[model samples]
Target: MAEIISDLRQDDVEDTVPGGIAADRLRSIIERIEKLEEERKARGDDISQVFAEAKGAGFDVKAIKQLLRIRKQTTEEVEQLENLVDLYRHALGM
Candidate 1:
């Protein structure tokens, strides 16, 4: 299995030009993307931890998340959404 993997890597090297600049650039781009993805995952975990702490503190996590979503929206957008919700509620006698 090790020999097969080595052979495959050798074939890949052979396919690239002698200078391998393109291959090196591609590798660098891929490594940077992987690093960013890892960082994003860590940040997500931190966010989840904060949410857990909020829940433990007796805050409603769902409402907090909803507020965060609303905070990201513009005032005009929120008013439009609220109007739509009110219209729909009235339609349904809610």
Candidate 2:
């Protein structure tokens, strides 16, 4: 499986949202994020760093990480179900 980088960490030039964030505020956020990433990486991707940074930012670390995990979907092992669905609905005339 390939490791993924969050969209927030990407370097795309286009603004994904329409009439999006003001340049100055966006830049500030990016700079802070860079510092956060540096702090995270310095600790070798220790998740505790995420909590620590969130804490320093005056945000709830535990809740934020929990929210980040709420919508994750793993598509890695769905091949068998997909094949079965196709086999019944298409191939087998059910």
Identify the candidate with maximal lDDT.
1
lDDT of 1 at 64: 100
Give me the displacement of residue 87 in model 2, in angstroms.
Answer: 35
Residue 41 C-alpha lDDT in model 1:
100
Which regions in candidate 1 have their CA more than 4 angstroms from the true location?
1-21
What Cα-based lDDT does every candidate model obtain? 0.82, 0.64
Q: Which candidate is the best by TM-score?
A: 1
Provide the clashing-pair count of each candidate structure. 0, 0
What TM-score does candidate 1 reach? 0.78
Judged by lDDT against the true structure, how good is candidate 1? Answer: 0.82
Cα displacement (angstroms), candidate 1, residue 40, comes to 0.5
Against the hidden reference, what TM-scores do the models get?
0.78, 0.27
lDDT tens string, model 2, 1-94? 1232133434432543554334454678889999999997878767777788889999987688756764453554355556778888987677
